[model samples]
Target: MTALYPLFADLDGRPVLIVGGGAVAERKTRALLHCGAAVRVGAPRLTRTLRAWAAEGRLAHLAEPYHEGWLESAWLVIAATDDRALNARVKAAADARRILANVVDDPALSSFQVPAIVDRAPLTIAISSGGAAPVLARRLRERLEALFDPALGALARLAGDHRAAIRTACPDHGARRRFYDWLHDGPVLAQLRAGEPAAAERTLRARLDGAGEESPPAHRLDWIDPCPADPGQLTLHQLRLLNEADVLVHDAGVGEAVLSLARRDADRHLLDAGERKDPGTLRDKILARCAGRGNTVALISQPA
Candidate 1:
């Protein structure tokens, strides 16, 4: 399976088009509106909620058949109608205009794939299988939804509030990482969970004021000998490395199963068929990244 680069688009106040009026289209409209997209629905009729929203001036109602004019000023378009021909036409029009389009249940016609989302407000987790197995992706999202605490959203918000201070306190890459690790593994989350938010803020300030943690090597490169492709087979140390590595450089032999263990925010560099034969070039690129502002941990399948 080929890789699909995951992205989180900020649609605030951006124009977006929806080419249907049924329940599926309604769902899309609600999500788009939540992201502050200026939605325009191009359908002859709308569902109860859709019609109500249109009447309330929450969204514009075209009240006509789908046409190329609907694509005007749209950052992206979604066709959720059951009519296959209509969906195809919408997809073609979007393509001609160079706009991202998604035709419901038709991955072949879509320029973008919507993933199963776990909404934590500030911290959202999305899972997708490149539209090959949406059921599996949704199932995984269910598991994660159960695993993550909703308090995590509040925690993230708190961290966001202090992000600048934290950056200033720990300027070195290694120190910043250790500080974040402390934030995660230490008492900040616990204090919030325990309903002592003031205590949590104080704890964060105490650390930033000067906890004095020794910073490790600024350029430590680690290699994981390729384990079983199964993610479940990874050892504790390997799991830690996968999640912690800021810059991952993997060979073609690494499967997605292993690759998926890395954090979504990680900078991943996957070597293609041609790049595999040229390890030296890949190494130089990794070194250049490491030499930048912060420390970088590059993942390799074997000794370079």
Candidate 2:
């Protein structure tokens, strides 16, 4: 199996070519449209919706069979045709041009695989199986959909609005991280969840100004047990915290799958039986390291 590096592409206003007009192509077109991508279809025939979009001048339609030059000026290409030879040709053309191509249902010929996405505007969560088990990835996406609140987008927008001010107030990276931790864990998130945006903003400002009630300490250790063997099995909250961690202290038995989810720059410390000889002493040592540093530590343990 080929190892793939996962990343999100910014397709806003970028030209994307779709080589089929079937349901699959239509689905891909809708997703592209959501991202504000400029879509161009090269199919001889299009789905009814695709035809409507073209008639409305939303996209360019070739109204002809696939050809070589269609790949020109395209940032990305999707081969969703039922014809194997045509899909192969599209893949080959995209490969020669170094353009990223996704051949629907044919991972072997494609350069990228589109993940099942949970869209919350600026906050999107994508789950992929590296073209190994798409259905499983979809199932995981569905599970996450229920866990993330739709109001998160509103909360994110609020944060974005105050980002400059927050950065100015908290010049230190660690201090900024603590402020965000407070924003997410304090009354601000609750107010937003309750649909009280004004109240949330008021609280956010108060906290930023240090006028609000004392926030929960940001420097603390989170002990996580029954750690997931597969990164895909981790809960959304776990994944978020892992990505936020400044330091990760884990037992030697912890799997790389879990560690890989942490921020790439996070400091890692492996704990052996010697370090575990006194649990309280180890906890104190970790806490001391975090003091005045605004560092958040994640202490992981294997399932007993």
Candidate 3:
């Protein structure tokens, strides 16, 4: 199957319809409500939680089965009914209106797949297996959920709050990158983790105010061992450097799969395979790159 387009919708105040009264429908309704969507459930009967939510005005409950009218004003619809025939009818109605619809557990009828989410608030990560391997997707999400610390969101928000000030202080794009690198690597996040937000803010302010250490040398070469066929095999440290690198100097044997991990705007210099025999060639290339802006990272891999 082709890759699905990934999207995050702002459903605040937007109307959406769910055509089931079961546990699955309840799950979908709660998620939509959390996103501020105006949820309307069109089922003859609802589960206990759904009934309670309807009573509390959390969502509008239609005491009737699925119909074409429900799709008239909906931004999207979830057909979670146990009846496949009924679900198919809902899918057809939604299709006639050009509305996006997802029939639960039926990817063939779904216009969009709801990915397994790793919610870090401002830093949400989503994983999908193209509806081919849902268990695998959930497993990946679990790993990410554990890998990312809860305080990471606080760190992101703090950085967001200082965005304008950071931009103004570090006018040079390269300088701004270094400042952010320092911000992430420095004591600010540690202070936040220690439950000292005030201290964290002070540290951030001090750095922006030039009371912090000077920006590290931005023009240097850091080489990685030969890249494996899969870029995912690289360590986190290596991935971080690749993500932040402004320049990539590599032998042609290094695949695009690995090169794609670096900043899309980074400069790429492909060294001659034969040049590896003589260390002077690479040294000269690094020297030339050092004369310019930003830092360089080379992948000293096997010759093509």
Candidate 4:
């Protein structure tokens, strides 16, 4: 099953060895340095960028080809060398030593696959094709690049900051879920998307204040016809319906762009029926919440 993995922290001062000095190695080196890793480049030759980085003391470049012993103390390794045999050898060594290694264009020889990434400040998205469709993965990433408004990070930060308050105020699972739905569908998402963080926060706070201890529970709208006239268009009607949906249960083949349109505050429930949502338990929860709020709950299914 596909899943969202937890974010890994940067290796600021940790040692990471890059085995090559060609174009591929340069690209890998740049990414490592950007993430604040103390990089060491081992190659018989170096490119202009590599030479400059070494000159600036940003990376340690050894003018000798890679030796297997270099893996002894390194935390992570990247075998970007042109030699396929050497990359495989390095991958095997890294695996034996429990170190993470990525071999360029060689998924079978890699311990970990490096995803095509989108770094939007505080929000970083990593996309992988399981080593099957790299070009397609990158194309999809470019499309996503246009969809995520810059204000998303600011809005995410605001939500993160008041997490404690929201938790304390809305103790009941139902209440909390409702609040997030309101927050996402309300003006907060639009405000942030328009590059107004302070306005978004103010609007959210006001909504929170207006809500009562036993505020009206959220109502789920009926399943929206995924078939809008323009299949590629995001209709306002759809947005309104989604805003009120407390839990969005969706299936695979849902377009990433379409899913991205969901209210940021909505409690997303992936429809993994048998293995995840115990049918009886989910049904009971839905029924109880709907009863409390006098709201009709709806389930949306993607068109097959």
**How high is the CA lDDT of each candidate model?**
0.82, 0.84, 0.85, 0.73
Give per-residue CA lDDT, model 2, range 173-233, as digits (tens): 6677778878877888788889999999999887788723344445756666657677788
Output the number of the TM-score-best candidate. 3
Candidate 4 C-alpha lDDT tens digits along 96-206? 999989898597667666777787656788888777888888999999999887666776788888787787777666677778877766789899888777888898878
Ranking by TM-score: 3, 2, 1, 4
Tens-digit lDDT track for model 3 on 1-304? 6769999999999999999989999988988998999999989989999999999999999998677877878999999999998998889888899889999969877998788988877888989888888889989999998898787788898999999999888877788887898888789989988988899999998889992345545476777866665798988989988987888888877899899989998888888766667776767766685566577787877633
The better candidate by lDDT, 1 or 3, is 3
lDDT of 3 at 118: 86
Judged by lDDT, which candidate is best?
3
> Predictions ranked by lDDT, top down?
3, 2, 1, 4
Residue-wise C-alpha lDDT for candidate 1, range 82-199, written one tens digit per residue: 8999999999999999999989969877889888989988999988888888889989999999999777887888889999998888876657877888998789989988888899
RMSD of each: 6.8, 4.9, 2.9, 7.4
> Which has the better TM-score: candidate 1, or candidate 3?
3
Error of 3 at 71 (Å): 0.6
Any idea what lDDT model 2 has?
Answer: 0.84
Candidate 1 residue 17 Cα shift, in angstroms, is: 0.4
